[model samples]
Each structure stands twice: as structure tokens, then as C-alpha cells.
Target chain A: MFQDFKSDPFMFCIVIGVILFVIAQSLFFLIRAVKRAKALGISNEKIKNTISSSAVFSIAPAISIAVTVLVLSVALGYVLPWIRLSVIGAISYEVPAAENAIEAAGLSSGIGADITDPKIFTAVAWVMSLGCILPLILIPLILKKIQKKVTGAVNKNAKWADIMAAAAFIGLICAFLGRGIAGTGELATNDAGEKINVTIGDGAGILSLAAIVSSILFMLALTLLNKKLQWKWLEAFSMPVAMILSMAVVVLISHFAPGLAAIEWRY
Target chain B: MMKKNRSYIDSVHFYGRIWCLLALCVMLLVPTLMSLHLKAWPDLGIVGKAFAATAVLFYPTAVVEVIAYAPLLGAGGTYLSFLTGNIVNLKLPCALNAMENVKVKANSEEGEVISTISIAASAIVTTLIIAVFVLIFAFNPKFTALMQSDTLAPAFKQVTYSIFGAIAATYFVKHWKLAIFPLAMVSLLLVFFGSIPIGILIFVGVIISLLGAQAMYKLKWV
Candidate 1:
């Protein structure tokens, strides 16, 4: 009678309910920000562009997250992964958290295994939910204090704040790039939270380098075109266009020019 | 067009706390509702054991991320962003792009509003896409195989690099002076150590870049 409890109807209700809550919260903030943007005299045109371009920018990345849902759905069923990927979940940790929980429950959850037992379901869901909940708690308590300091800095030294903002993103971009190229380190955990060693250049071997290079070229081209040609409207679309085009280029390379699209270290 | 005090930023925190707290409740309820609906309260001791293991690995990562990202994302963005997740790959870039397009400082009133708008848009779009994907996968088993097709796998595999590369282009090209120090330092570290945790790397990344920015500012080079 309980053959497929993992995808049970009741489970879908809970997942959908939580997702709806997220959408509602997002809408509330969106509307509030839009109204505030206007009072601040940020042209309606600017707000509109930000919304539209941000929506466009999100598509390729969101599709990739959907792919994560597909991957995790195999072990725990669809609803749990859907919820996990949607909220407070990072791709790096969700799978490992489930693996750890299942290992504790004495069941193997190696992606394709038949881990649909009810006990396994409860265990995976609980761990995936609780494991990433700290941010939910800590963000509320500390974000305000953190934001205060940032605002204080900006108000105190306007020039320095601008430099700090620029520095913050540059550092993040380079760090992620280096991490991607240098390979995830020994401290990086595997599916069950065990530390694993990775060769320094192992992450560099990714044929996905095609996508990175393509994105760089595409973005630089767009930026240059915008500046030289004064295609002011084109500036907002650059990030999304570059990302989507880069993904498309890699897809073609992998299929037609297969060797050029070597798939390595997807994480 | 200026105010005596930062009331708007304060209101952002005001409304932000309510939204974030409410979201947390719903998050906790996902598991709570599941156990009730299934009539299967997981054995407390086992749940505890597994949680302790997972928590040890993730809890520190979460703390580090919050500290690193809060300043960049601002009050409203941070509140909404941490709840929605996928900060670096998605939200951070979206907010940055929006601010760049509009030409505002990240900590300014206009930047805060713009950041909130873009992040909220990004979050909604992401949730909606995943929801649609879930429905399709549930209705049609073949859809999974189609999505997993070899033709599309490469794109999925390269999504992060695609995102970071695109985001990096914006900052590095414009701020080459400031970019040089941190990017070089990261490269040196990756080559020499090759094994730092990403959470720690992020902390390192933000610190060095700030230092780089400070040094350049003092030198009047930027």
C-alpha cells in the first residue's frame, strides 16, 4: 500500500506550500523595493530595467538548479529535493548531508540506490532540512548588525565604501575562479562529509573551461560594444546574454566537437 | 535628495526581520509537516546522530558565508538572499549587475532598493523555474532522461564557471589595479596550498580584496 511514499501526494502538498511561501515573500519584497526605488527618484525606467534584466539573468542559473533537483530527486524522491534546492540549500552540501543521514540510518544513498524506504525518507529529509538551517537562524540575528556596520562605513567615508564594494565582488569572483581552476582542496568533503583530497590542477582539467572562456569573451565584447557604440540599452542584458550564449556554445562543443567539451569536476 | 538619517535602510531592516523570521518558520515546518503527514516521527536518537554529523560539516560554512556575504548583499538583500540560497552563483551576480547597470554604490539607499528588487526577482524566477521542472519530471519520466542527455550535460556541468566568468569580467576589467593583487594572491595560494576549504577561501578572498582596495586608495592609484 505504501510502495511509493516518497512521492506521496501529501508530500507534494508540503513542498508546494513551502515554495509558495517563498514566492510570496519575494513578491512582497519586490513590490516594496519598487515603491521605495521610486521615492528615492530612481527612474521608473531604471527599476523596470533592473527587474527585467535580473529576471533574464536568472534563467540559465535557475535551469541549472532545476538540474540539481533532478539529481537529488533520484535518491529521496521529487518533493524533498525540490524543497531542499529551493531553500537554504547549497549544491555542495545537500547531497553530502543526505548521504550522511542515510549512512547513519544504515542505508546506502549512492544516487541510484533504491533508498526509498520510509525510514530513509524521514532521515534524508530531516538532515537536509536541519543541516542548512543555521543560516536561517543566524541571518536574522546578525544581518542587521552587519548591515549597520556597512551602512556606518558608507556614511562615514563615502569614497572608501565605494572601493570596498568593488573589492568585495572582485575578491569573490577571483576566489571562485581560483577554486574552480585549482581543484577543490583536501578539506572539501565528499557525499558523506568525509574530507577528501583533490589534486591542485584537477579542477583545471574541466572542459567547462570552454564555457568560462566563452563567457569572458562574450561579456567583454558586450561591454566594449556598449561603451564604444553607446548601446546604453544593451548594458543591462550583458550578463544573461553572456551566460546563456556560453552555455549554448559549450553544448554545441560537447556534442559536435565532443573533445573540446570535456566534462570534469562538475561541482 | 538626502535625508538627515538613514530611515530607508532602517525600514529595510524593520521589514526584513519580519519576512526572514516568517520564512524560517515555514522552513522548519517542511520537515515538521512531513513527519506528521507520514505518521513517522523519525527516531529522535538517530535523527540527532545524523544531524550532528551534517551540522558539524555545514554549520561553520553557513556562519562564514553569512559574515562574508552580508556586507555585499546589504540588509534587505541579505535577508532575502540567505533564505533563497545559491548566493554566489545567482543572487550576488544579479544584484551586482543591477547596481552596475543603474550606477549606484552597493551601500547607498538607491543601491539597497535596487539590490532588493533584483534579488527578489532572481529568487522568484528561480523558484518558479524549479517548480515547473518538478511538475514536468513528475508527469513524465522520460523528461529526466531528456534533461540528462549528453548534449545538455556539458552546459549543466559548466554553469558555475559560466556564472563566475561572466561576473568576473565586470569587475576585473574595470578595476584591473585592485584586481591584480587579490587574483594574483588567490592564484599563488591555489598553486602552493591547493587544499583550502571554499568557505575559508571566501573569507580569504574578501579580506585580501579589501586590503588591496585600501592600499590602492591610499596610493591614489585607483
Candidate 2:
């Protein structure tokens, strides 16, 4: 059973999931930076520069993730057998036997069977998993080096980078909420003996539209409340966060709900 | 003006033309590797086939092809196109490196933005040119059949268009915020429909985006 998981193409899931996790944290940092800009009431040009710089900075990890995934994807195609043996193995007892063998090999720990079992399903899941900060921890130090080289000792563009980071956070969140469902849905099974089609189709279109509308409204609101929001970065981040949260809620509700219940939250 | 042009040429040195050259060598080697692999395992697994296909598309040869001919086609336009297509999904690092290059020459914030925009424009134009070439060269039955065979045409077309789509997307995302939606839609449609070669789709999209950008200029949308 554990070997099945290791051999399955789903192994790539762990790698991609870790990448998404990094993306999520990066967005949070971006939000904080945007809030800072809103408090200061920076100029649009300045805001844009900040956003663009931070965007550039944030893009590094995202690119690394994409490149790593692409390379891994290529590696998968090159080394792995394309035709899945899952169907045959599912009906056979070989899967469970293999699982037991692996567990026996791992019994040296002398722990409980559940814990000692290498087939616990979580071992292979953790193989490609870099710790949470593995991807993101280098970003600030990298940015600082880049900043020193670009703007010199003064760190002139640091503020602008902060603002840009906020915008990136918003973009990252939007991507996460939009694609995360699809990603998770790939693993989703139809317990009811139905065909598992993960695509949300034109249904999610309505949620996307609402997200856009609410975001625009939120941005306008933030602009109007600019002075009250105090922090320019906070004001900048609010519209995007509001939009992201709204979309995330819509997607999560739709995904978790049953078919009939899912349709209810579509709009 | 002459002196400024000369200075611009000088600055290309700072852009790490060496890395660009390395990318070129990789493009050339990819096809050879693919052919060798194909000979070794004609019926490799699905993953294997995917790798081979990706090699054809993203190989350093493609990069080299763009860098070598893009400038020769007109100026640095094609080189930028190749660069843009190669880095489309990976924008941040590309942009930051580009920003560093701009900062080397630009003294003011406005100058930095302008330089960045100009590089972007040139990149788009170059990619458009390559897309046109690939589409016409690969998709046209006459061209494909004459060079290789009819069956080879589809493979050629796929890679050509992939590059075209990638470059067009990069350009669209940089200029107008709204441009991304339509460009993305068109790209999806093109990919799904296997419509005319990627170049033709991108050519059409580029024209439309240009018109839109011009209209925005007229309406002060920028």
C-alpha cells in the first residue's frame, strides 16, 4: 500500500503542495508590506514602484518553484512509466503485502505497529517536503543582496518593495484560491460511484465575477477611507485581501458542499 | 543619438550575455539528446514522452534560435522575444535582473520605468516575429512536407505555437491590466481548438492588444 503511494504519480503532490504553501506565506508577508504603504499614503507612482520591486523580489521563489516543478515534471515523464498499473494492483492483494513488507523493515524502531510501520502513508509524503520555511526563508536575504546591488547601501527602493510585496500577496492569494481547489480536487474521489470530474466548469465563473466586483468596491472604499486607514500599505492590501477572502470562502464552500449544496453557493 | 545608441550596445555586456549564450548551447543539444533517447526507447513511458516533448520545446536550442536570429531579423527584437518566451511564467527574477540593468543607466524613477517598458516592448515584438516564422514554417503543409513529412508538421506546429503563446502572454501581462484576461482567453481557445498556428493567433492578438493599448492611450487609460 505504501509502495503504491510512492509509485503513484500522486507523489508529485507533495512537491507541489509544499510550493503552494510557500506561495501562501509569501502572500501574507506581501499583505503586511501593503498595509505599511497605505498607512503612509504613498504616491501612486511610488506605490507602483514599490509593488513592482516587491513583485520582482517575490517572483524569485515563485519562479524557483515553477522551475523545480517543471524540471520534476520533465523528470517524471522521462523516468516513470506513463501507463498506470493502479487498476490491476487495486484488485490484487500485492498492495497490502508490499505494505506489510515495508512496515516489517521499519520495525527496528520498536514502536507501536502504527507508528513503526513505514507504510503509514505519511513517510513518502514527507520525502519531498522541505520544511515550511525551506522555500521562503531565503527570500528576504536574497532581496537584501539584490537591493544592495541595485539601490546600494541606502536601500532606497525598500519601501516600494514593501508595497509591491502587498500586491504580490494579493495576486498569490487569488492564484491559490482559484487553483488550490483544482489541485485538491484532483485527489477528490466520488464516494457516490460517480465519475470524478474535478473541473468547476462555468459555475466558478460566477464566483470569479463576484470576487472581481467586491474587490473593485473594496478598493474604492479603501481609497475613500485612505486617511482613516492611516497605513497606506494596509489600505492597499484591504481590497485585495477582501477579494481573496471572498473568493476563498466561495471556493471552499462550493468544494466541500455536496453537489446540490455546492450549486447553492455558486453565485 | 548615435552616441546614445553606441552606449546602449555597450550596456548589453552587463546583461550577462554569457548566460544567454549558455542557454543557446542547451537549445542545440536538446534535439540531439531527444533523438538519441528516441532511438534507445522508441516506446518509452508517458512520462518519458512528455520529457522528450518538453526537450523539443524548451531546449537551449530554442533559446539559441531566438537569441541568434532575433537580432538578425531586425535588431535585438527577436532576442528579447526568445528571452520573454523562455521566462514568461518566471517573471520576477527576469524583471529584477532587468531592473538592475536599467538602474545601471537610468538616473531617475521615470527613466527606470521607461527603460523597463521599452525592453518589454522590444521583447514582445521579437517574440511576435518568431511566432510568425514558426507558424508559417511548421503549420503550412507545403513547408513541413517539403522539409520532412506531413506527420512531422504537427510536432513542429505544437512547439512553435507554444513559444508564440508564451511570448504573447508575457507582453500582454506587462502593458495593460485588462489585456491579460483577453490574451489568456484567446490563448486557451487557441490551444484547445488547435486553431491556426500559434504565430497567427499571437499575431492577431498582438494587433488587437496594440489597438487596445492605442485606444487606452487615446482615452488616457494608462
Backbone collision tally, model 2: 24
Return the clash pairs for model 1, or none.
Answer: none
On a 0 to 100 scale, what is the lDDT of residue A91 in model 1? 75
Each candidate: RMSD: 3.5, 19.4
lDDT of 1 by residue, A162-218 (tens): 888888888888887877676443344467745565432225544546777889999
Question: Per-residue CA lDDT of candidate 1, range B113-215, in tens?
Answer: 9999999999999999989987887787798788888788668867878888888888888888888889889878977766676667777988999998998
lDDT of 2 by residue, A1-267 (tens): 223322233433332332233233223323432343345453455545445432332222222222222122221221111111100011012122222322333422211123322222222111111111111222212322332343441256543332332222223222222221111122113544343545432222333333334434544454456667576554423322333344344344344543532331221
Each model's C-alpha lDDT?
Answer: 0.81, 0.30
The DockQ values of the predictions, listed in order, are 0.64, 0.03
Candidate 1 wrongly placed segments (more than 4 Å): A1-3, A184-202, A263-267, B1-6
Residue A88's lDDT in candidate 2: 9
For the record, the alpha-carbon RMSD of candidate 2 to the native fold, in angstroms, is: 19.4
Instruction: Give the number of the best model, judged by DockQ.
Output: 1
